[model samples]
Target: MDLPQLGTNLLNRVPPRLLSAAERYLKSVPLLRNRLEKETDSMLAGLEGDLKPYRGQLPTFATLPTQGLSHEQVLGEMSQMKEKEEHRWKDGLVSGAVYHGDSEHIDFLNRVYALNSQSNPLHADLWPSATKFEAEVVAMTAHMLGATEANAGRPPEQHICGALSSGGTESIMLAMKTYRDWARETKGITRPEMVAPSTAHTAFDKAAHYFGIKMVRVPVGPDYRADVKATRKALNRNTIVIIGSAPSFPHGTIDPIEELSELARKRRIGFHTDACLGGFVLPWARKLGYPVPEFDFRLPGVTSMSADTHKFGYAAKGTSVVLYRGTALRSHQYFTATEWPGGIYFSPTFSGSRPGALIAAAWASLVSTGEEGYLDATRRILETADAIKRGIRAIPGLHVLGEPLFVIAFGSDIVDIYKVMERMSARGWSLNGLHKPAAVHICVTQRHTQPGVAERFLEDLRAAVEHVRANPGEKGTMAPVYGMAGTVPFRGILSDLLKKYMDLLYKV
Candidate 1:
C-alpha cells in the first residue's frame, strides 16, 4: 500500500481526541508542514489553468487601471466572457448553477434589476418600494409554503412570517442563529446544540461553527432518508432544534419530516425544515400527484423553513426566503444596535446594506411566474427527472439512490462512479460529486426541461459509463482526487486542501 494510505489506516485506529492531537502535532513539525505545503502547492498549480482561464486571454488587473475604462470597452469584455461561459448552462450541460435559462425570463429579470439598481432595502425611508417588494416576496413565499394553512385560527403575530435573504445559505444560517438566540433566552440553554440527519446541508455545520452551537448528526436510514430513531436518540436537553431536509442535496431524498418534526414538537424544541432545494418544487410536485410529504409550516412542529427563490422559484440568482412560525421567533433573528453612533442601526439579515435589486428581481420572478407557471415548470422538471432516473437505472451497473422527484442521485456497485463522473466531465457535462457512499447527482432544473436535453444527458451518461467499464486501468485527472477525498480517513488533510483551494480562488 502507498505510504499515505497506510498512514491514514493507522490514524483511523486512533481515538478521536488523540487523532486530532496527532494531526496537530504532525502539522506542527516543520518538515511535515513543508512537505504538505509543497504537495498542496503542486496540486493547486495544476488547477490554476482551468480556474484562471482568462489569465493570458484577457487583460489582468493587479491594481486598477490608471484611468477608468470606457463603458463600451467594459461591456465588450464582459460580453465576450459571458458568451464563452453561457453555452454549458444554456444547453443544460450543467447541474444546478442556472435554473431557468429562458431568454424572455432572463430579459425580464434583467430589466427589473436595472430599474431597481439604486434601491437599498436598508434605507427603507428613502426606498419604500424596495421594502414593499421584499415584504411581498416573503409573504408570497410563506403562503406558498403553507403559511395560510398554518395561520388558521392564529393571531397575525403567530402567523407564518419571514425575511428576505441573499440565498439559501444565508437563510439557513439566519434560522440557525435565530434558534440559538431563542433557545438561550427562552429555554435558558447556555450550551446550544442542533440535531440533524447526516444528509443535512453543510450550511448547518457552518452555522454551528459560527454560532457556537454543537451539531449532532445522526445516521440516515437504508432508504437514504433520516433515521427517526437515530435522530431521537441524538437529541438531548441541549438540543435547540431538530433539522430535516425536504430533499437533501447529496442523495435527493426527503427526510421523514413529519416524524422528525413531531419529535421536536414533543420536546418543545425548534424544528427547521430546510426546503431550500424542494421548497419551490415539492409543493408543486404534490399538487401534480407526486408523493411529497408534509414539510412546510402546515406541520405544527415545523417552526421555521428556508426556501430559495433563486433555484426553482425562477428568480434571479441572489434571493431566498426564511420563514418563522411566528413573529416572536423571527424577532430573535433581528439585529438592532441602539448603542452604535450610526443612529440606532437595525438589519433583518446578516448584511446591513442589501441588494434591493435582487429583491426586486425575486419579487418580479414570483409575481410573473405565479402559481400556474411554477406548476408547469415543476411538471416538466419532474417528468424530465423521471426519465433521467429511468435511464440511469437502465444503465447495467448503475442504480438510482432513492425515489426522487426532481433532483436525482445515482451510484454503481460495479463501476468507479468517480471515473464515470470524470468521463461525463470530459464530455462537457458538469455534475455534482457526492461522497459518504460515493455517488453523483444532477439537480434537474428548467434548463433540462428543454427539448431533447434529457435524452442527450442519458446518451452522454451511458457512453461515459461504458467507457469507464471498458477501460478500468486508465488513469483520470479528477477521478483519483475524488476517490481519495471519499475514502481518506484523515479529514483534516482534505479540509486543509480545500482551504488552500479557496486561497487559490483569491489569487487572481
Candidate 2:
C-alpha cells in the first residue's frame, strides 16, 4: 500500500502485470483505503469553489421551496446567471460548449421548444407529430451519413435506422448495450466486450461499466488513428463490437475507420464509429472539400454510429442520434415488457418518457438548416479552425496534434499548457485539459467562427502563453489540479476524487 495501485481488468485491452498485482495487494489494506478516501476528499475540496460558483450568491435551495417563488423573481435570477455565463460562450471564449450561437438560430430553436414544451414521445400514440419529427430526424441524419449508398440494395429492415437519445453519452451507452445483447443472442457470445481506440470517447467506458460489457482499449497509431493491427490482435471470441471515432474527442483526428471497419468485417463483428463530435460536421466538411478521412456508413463494416445532434447538428442540447446498420441491430436497443401491471409497455430508448420538445427542436434545426445551411456553417467553422490551427502552430512554444478538421488540441514544450489554460480562464476563455502527454484543446464550433472570434482567441492564447512563460514559479489556478491528475499514478485516488466532484455537482 506504500505505492499507488492500478485498477483491475483490461486497461488498454489488458492490465499491466505489476499494476494487477499491486491493485490486489493495496486493496487488501484497510488503512490504505481510509487514507485514499481522505486524500480524495481533500482534492475534491480544492475543486469545490469553481464547481459551485453560486455557493454564496443568490438564495440556494438544496430542495424545492415550501412554496414556489414568484415567476418574475425566478426569471430575474436566472437571467442574471445566464448573463454571467452567456458572455463567455456567446463571445466565443469557450471550447465546444456552444455550437451555433447566432441569435436568429437560437431564437428559432427556442420558439420550436416553447411550442412543443408539453410534448412527450412516450405518449407518441397521442403526440404523433413528435413521432413524425423523430422519425424524419433519424432518416435525415442517416442520408447525410451515407446510409443511402450503404442501403441501396438492402431491405428496410436492413437499412440504417436509429433512435434519439438524451445526449452523446446516452446514445453511446445504448449502442454498447445493443451490441452486448446482439452478440449474446445472435453470435452465442455469452461474455461481451467492445474494442475501441484509446482516443475514443469516455462514454464507452461508462457503457462498459453500466452494462457489464468489458471494454478493450487499444492504442492509437503514430497518426493518432486507431491501430488496426493492434485492434485485430486485441479482439477475442467475446468481443461483440469494435469502435473507431470519426475524429475522436481528444485528438480530433479521425481513426482509419475504413481499415478498422474492414478488420471488424473480416471477423464478422460490429464496428461502431462514434461521430458524436464530428458526425454532423464531417459530412459537411467532406462536401466542402476539406481533407476529411472516410469515417461513416460508406464503410461496409460500420454497423453502428453515434452523432450528437446537440453538438454540430445545431439542435438544443439534449438530443443525439445512435444509428444501426439495420433495424435488426437497433431492435436490441429497445426495451419491451408485457404482462406487467403497467400492461404491455415498450421504450425505444433508456427513458420511458422522453422530452419530445428537444426532438422537435432537433427536427426543426435539421430541416430549417438544410443542406445549404450545413454547408455554410461547416465552411465558416473549418476556416476558423484552420486559422486557429495556424495560430497555435505559429506560437513558439506550441505544436498542433494530428491532422484535425475542427476540434484542435495543442501542446507546449516551453510552458505548462495547463497553466496557459488557467490564464485563458482568467481572461474568460474556458478550454479543456488533456493528459497522457499534457495538452489543451478547443473544439471549434459556429460560435468560434464569428467575425473577429478566431482572431480574439489567438490574441488571448498568445497573451496567456506569454503570461505563463513569464510566471515560472506561480502555481496558477487548475494547473496544480491538472498536474496532480496527470502525475498521480494512484487511479483509485483520482477516481474517488472524481466521485466527490460529482457529488459537489449535485449540491444545491
Candidate 3:
C-alpha cells in the first residue's frame, strides 16, 4: 500500500481523542504543515477561475472609490452580472437555491423589498409595520405547522410563540441556545448536552460549538431514519434537548419524531423538530395525501421547530421562523440588559438589527401565496420529484436512497457517483454532493416543475451514468476531491481544506 493510504489507515484506528492529539502533533511538524499548505494551495488555485469569474472581466475594487459611482453606472454593472449569473438557476438547472423563479413573483417581492428598505426590526417604535410583518410571519408559519391545534386548550403564555430569524441556521442556533439557557436556569444543568440523529442538520453541531453544549449523535436505522432505541441509549442527565429532522438534508427521510419527541417529553426534556427543509412543503404534502408522519406542533412532545420561509415557502431569501411551545421557553432565547450605559436594551433573535425588508417579504409571501398557492406549489414539486425518482430508479446502476418527497438522493453501485455529479455539473446542473454514503441529490423547486426540465434531467443523468460506466479510467477535477472527502480517514485534513476554501472565497 502507498504511504499516505497506510498513514490514513493507521490514523483511522486511533481513538478520536488520540487522533485529535495526533493531528495537532503532526501539524506542529514544519515539513508536514508546509506540505499540507502547498497541496491545498495547488488544489484551490485550479478552482479560483471558476469561483472568481468576474475578475479581469469586471472592475476589481480592493479599495473604495474616492467618490461613489453614479447610480446609473452602479445599476449597469449589477445588471450585467445579473444577466450573466441568472440563467443557470432561471433555466431550472440549479437545485434548491431558487425556489420560486417566476418573473411576476420576483417583481412583486422586489417591490415589497424596496418599500421596506429603510425599516429595521430593531427599532420597533420607528417601524411598527416591520414589527407587524415579523409577528404575523411567525404566526402564519406557526399556524401552518399546527400551532392552532397545539394552542387549542392552552393559555396565551403556553401557546406557540416564536421570532423571525435570518435563516434556518440562525433559527436552529437560537433554539439550541434557548434550550441550554432554559436547562441551566430551570433544571440546573450547566454542562448541557443534546441528542440528535446523525442525519440531523449540522447547524446543531454549529450551535453546540457556539453555545458550549455537548452534541451526542446517534445512528440511523436501515431505512435511513433515526434509530429511536439508539437515541434513548445516548441520552443522559446532561441531555437538555433531543433533535429530529422533519426530513433530513442528505437522505431526505424524516426521522421518527413521534417516538423521539415522546422520549424527550417522558424525560421532561426539550424536543426540537428541524423542519427547515420540509416545514413549508410537508404541511401541504399531508393535505395532498402524501404519507408524511407527525412531525410538528400537532405532536404534544415537540417543544420547538424551525421553518424557512426562504425555501419552499417561496419567500425571498434570508427569512425563517423559530417556534417554541411556550413563552417561558422562548424567554430564554431573548437577551436583555438593564444597567447598560447606553440604556436598557433587548433583542429577540441573535442580531441587534435585522433586515425588516426580508421580514416584510416573508409576510408578503405567506399572505400572498396563501394555503391554496402553497398546496398548488407542493403538488407540482412533489409530482416533479416523483417523476425524477422514477427516472433515477429506472436507470440500471443508480438507486434512490430513501422514500424522499422533494429532495431526491440517489447513488450508483456500478460507478462512481461523484463522477456522475461532475458530468451533471458539466451540463449546467448544480446538484448537491453528499458523503457518508457517497451520493448526489437535486432539491426540486418550482423551477424543476417547469415544462421539459424533468425529462431533460433524466436524459442527462442516464447519459452521465453511461459515460462514467464506459470510461472508468477517466479522472475528473471534483470527483477525486469528493472521493477523498468521503473516504479519507483524516477528518482534520478535510476540515483544513474547507477552512482554506473559505479563505479563498474572501479573495478579491
Q: lDDT of each model, Cα atoms only?
A: 0.92, 0.89, 0.94
Each candidate: how many clashes? 0, 0, 0
lDDT, residue 329, model 3: 97
Q: Report the lDDT tens digits of candidate 2 across residue range 1-508.
A: 2233242213433555666677667767999877777776766777778877976788898789999999999999999899877888888888998898889999999999999999999998889999999999999999999999999988888999999999999999999999999998999998799999889999999999999998899998777888988998998999889998988898899998899899889989999999999888989888888888788898899999999999999999989999999988999999999879978999999999899999999999999999999999999999999999999998889999888888899998789999999988888888999986788999998888778989988999999888888988899657877887876655765676777778888877
Candidate 3 positional error at 57, Å: 0.7
Ranked by lDDT, top first? 3, 1, 2
Pairs that collide in candidate 2 are none
Question: Could you estimate the TM-score for every candidate?
Answer: 0.97, 0.94, 0.98
Q: Pull out the clashing pairs in model 3.
A: none
For residues 284-369, could you state the per-residue lDDT of candidate 3 as single tens digits? 99999999999999999999999999998888999999999999999999999999999999999899999999999999988999
RMSD of each: 1.6, 3.4, 1.5
Ranking by TM-score: 3, 1, 2
Please report, as a residue range, the 10-residue window in candidate 2 with the lowest summed lDDT. 1-10
Worst 10 residues of 3 by lDDT: 4-13
